[model samples]
Target: MKATATMVLFPELQSENDTIASQLLLLPQNITKNPCENDRTCNKDSVNINVVWLDSTSHSHFYRSMPKTVQILRDIKESGSLNVFSYNLMQSLKGGTYVNTVAFTSGKIFSRSYLQSKKRGIGNLFNLFQNGGYHVSMIDDLCWTWSAANCACGIPTFMGVKTQSWISEVVLGKRVTIPELWGNFSKELKLRGLNDIGASLANCEIMKANGITDPFFTGKSKVAICYNGLYQTDYLMSSLELLQSQLNRANRPHFSYLDINLGHESTGRRIQTLDVSLAKFMSFLGRQNNTLTFMFGDHGNKYGTFVQKSKESKIEMAHPVLFVLASNDVATKLGRDWMRALDINQNRLVNILDLRQTVLSLAPNVDVESFPINAKYDNHPNGLFHPISRKRSCDSMGIAPEAGKCICYQGRVLQRVSNQTGVVVLANFALGELNNKIQEQFLAANGNESSGFGNCRYLIGSWITNVQQTVSQNITITEMDIHIPAGTGAPQSEDVFSVTIQVGSNIPALSTNIKLVHHERISTYAVYDDCRDVGVDGDLCVCSATPTLQSWHIDPPTIFGYISTVINLTRYLYIYERRTPHGLNLETSCDSADKTFEVVMRITSKVNVGYSKKYPLTFKVKHGTIFFIDVFYQLNPKLNWDVKYDVDFKQL
Candidate 1:
């Protein structure tokens, strides 16, 4: 017995021409012929794939943000027609949208170095579908620009099929004018009654008409329409309608990829607005037996107030939402064991690579049972067609640190290490790696560009705000929040970065001790105007500032000190200056035999102090029972001073 679901739609939001629900109701209730006799008999030409990639939405977020959509999905899953993967981890947490897309499209692991290399010749799933005589179409705003800016994975022509470009003209209204490459596609949209969508996008006029007073859209390009008063569902509806147009006349099979930036803005809270459209789309898919839909997200929130709202918000960035909806006929063809595997893999650690493999398994003449049902490492892809190891580690899945920390294991928890010395060293090291990546990206650009490396200022580590780590079996994973002076425009403003690194216990070998796994700028870098097209992570760049007069007032210089627990240490060093010197240098000397630890200096400025700043030096010696600290400072060659002190930790 097949279960039925109530169709949900927002009638007030629909146009008069013909409702989507009404149109779906007109389709055949049952497929006349089996698209594939069984899983082993399906040809690519007989299987239709409709993929909807939602940006910045995670598994937890989907349920919290869209209760209506979740209920609809639950109904489908209960009907035994849908398979939901509870643990679909993303390939990259910090690589952004472009890197994640390329990973699944090619079914390969992507790294910052790989994207920087611009290596080509890797075949993609789209090309496979095209070669199998399937009609292929991709709809997105920035997909084309992202492809052109990076590797040439044949994005424009996947197997020589020209991708449909729907930028400025369709995505942004005519208020923002730009040339359209595929002009005929716009006409096709008009014929399909989707011409109103472009005009309905949030624009200056629309904002005024709707009485929206938020300045969020002021400096942003017309393309960045997060809180534009208009619901983002407009783009989703248009894409689904366009896909519907193809299905109406599809002779063989059709593959349509809809990658939209609908839920990326507003801390991803905007996903709630997609409930009605999403419910309708899923309802329509429920009636089709030959089509398969992959609805998922790239990663979670990268920035905004929402990420700082709670701990769950921060963790969701690595846990993207993935739902695979298969028709009843397709499910039956895949067999009972495959269905069992699907049930088991939902809770296992899986990613886009596995999704790609599962799609390929449906290709023509692929024996479904050729691969073992219980094999740990199947020679074939590790898709849901077989079981994914519950013990899978991120490294085994070819995941890099840039993707985010692994959450699959139970005992690998990252706890606070309380070592300020180690935090400072690792923070600086991570910043160095970030800057090197920025420099490499800048150097890769041809000299034709005006905004080059010279336009951006290199970032420096200001202070270590938070330090955390977890060690198990001699392996350590450390996370830190470091502050830097990469702010928008304020004189004393700063930006905070969250970094995660892995290290071995070889404290003596600090040179090869720490490795950066993931890093993200938690604060906004809106001041990236000067170096707009520099081709590097814009947040990593701080535009160079014009020369300004520098002055500092130094009252009688004084030093303060205090001693706390062995696990906690605090020291304060205050410096006041009247005139800025050519340079300032800080040196530290320790009277301990072991050189495993070092001192860290934190710099701060106070506007109330009238041109005076504070410098607090903190030290930690983990190996020695007792140690002496000597510090020397020089405002300039003319001014020099030194402070020496020793304390015994053995008494504590």
Candidate 2:
């Protein structure tokens, strides 16, 4: 009963000898290539711009934690540093935790697939500058993965390797077995005319007697930034002093980016005392000509001294420092109206991507201000590097509140509701009507929880305070015992903790309705054998590595036993006491992801435990991309190139 079109009746669809001419006529009108000819500022000739970018890692909220970083910033403010700008609460393009993602891709659509394509090129700046005839070189104490074949470097090797490492270190208590160098970049640079001036470790010695090892000059077209101090220096002060010295050496009328890895990532955990040294550098640079400077923190110290404070205080850990200064000449170049516009945006928000947009404006060929704000996306064309409205929300800037670490409360404060919506404790009489004393303790206990807190989940230090309202009413008391982990010796090893609470209606209660209520919060951490490398730049403890307790809340911290079982009990024992990992950790809150894991765990263990197993189980289909691993792993070119999908969840 099938019909076939084997006859010549469909001859109109056939190709003719002049098909080339016909094909050109069928081209789509909307798509075009490099369509910037119409802009008055779009000049096809070579650009005239110079830049010195100093890329630092970590040290968020430096202004609050390190007065020295601020003093230097203040000095820059008095100098040619730009205005205080923000990435508008944006996280790194690769991931939320920031360390693993591309350290510098802003305003670009990011996803695993998108990243695979962009991975060949480390950053947009490199390409933009190189095309504009600039020689770019990075001088740092750390080796940057810019323009290489690895994640840290821009190389297009399999991400599975890093994904495995990311999972093993964070989710499971496994060693960092991923290979740091997978495959060599096909060429020295992904694009022609770029250079990896290999200046790291002690190679800064190369730049000692003379300048960079190679001639870092070519027709005055050069963009280079260097980091002097290091987190590994005997004293952080020594490094800061070194950094101050380096800042004094930038005697050019170019845009310079400086990143001091002080207040280093969680690993250094070192107290930063940089005010005096930074002040000297800033003061000196403030008097320079046609210079622009910026001072900011990458992120708060991951496991710094103040990480365990209240939610408000912990927020500072997420909010990094940001200050900008610029010279008079540079101000005039940006235009006087741009300067006046800054007045209207006194307290606007910012993020890293916005920084990207601002930097893009520096390229004279791409005239960003020629167009209005993106009508569809709501982003300002000029970005924060110029002027942004004070009322700009994270949405307008394309930075989500959670990802950008935005702390604006926006009037969402907590208060008591009516008794019908509050109140109640059972008559078990164990805790006696859940009086004000216990409620006050939990409220003031920095929430004493994180995930499922609204439903009264208990985590040791997460700060949960929303349920105090219902505590005032007569409520029934409920009780539950915490399961303690077991192992004991001169070094005790057991994960056990206990908790009791009252349960009732109208109050947040961790009742049995939840999907999976169990112990163990899976956390990802950049642990290292040399505890010193804990929070170093690149977040890769791949060098001297060890398995660390992934939990940030653990005071002394937990790490795996380096020795074999029972060989050296004390050696393997956790330095800190155990808090039953029984509460809801943020990573485990993905209900669907949890279900997937639980099923996988069941199927694997079922056979070993003599239980009937459904090797191929039927699961409900969600209205989104449901990937089968085989499709991605086999390197199906057609699928890999075209089958990518993005899932956007809408909040109720």
Q: Each prediction's TM-score against the native?
A: 0.63, 0.46
Off by over 4 Å in 2: 1-60, 72-106, 109-121, 144-257, 267-280, 369-377, 385-387, 395-404, 411-524, 528-652
Residue pairs with colliding backbones in model 1 are 92-403, 93-403, 401-517, 552-577, 552-578, 553-577, 553-578, 554-576, 554-577, 554-578
Q: What's the lDDT for all of these models?
A: 0.49, 0.31
Indicate which candidate wins on lDDT.
1
Give the C-alpha lDDT of model 2.
Answer: 0.31
What lDDT tens digits, residue by residue, belong to model 2 across residues 305-354? 23322334334534554555556666777777765654344455555555
Tell me the deviation in Å of residue 322 in model 1. 1.0
For all candidates, the clash counts are 10, 53
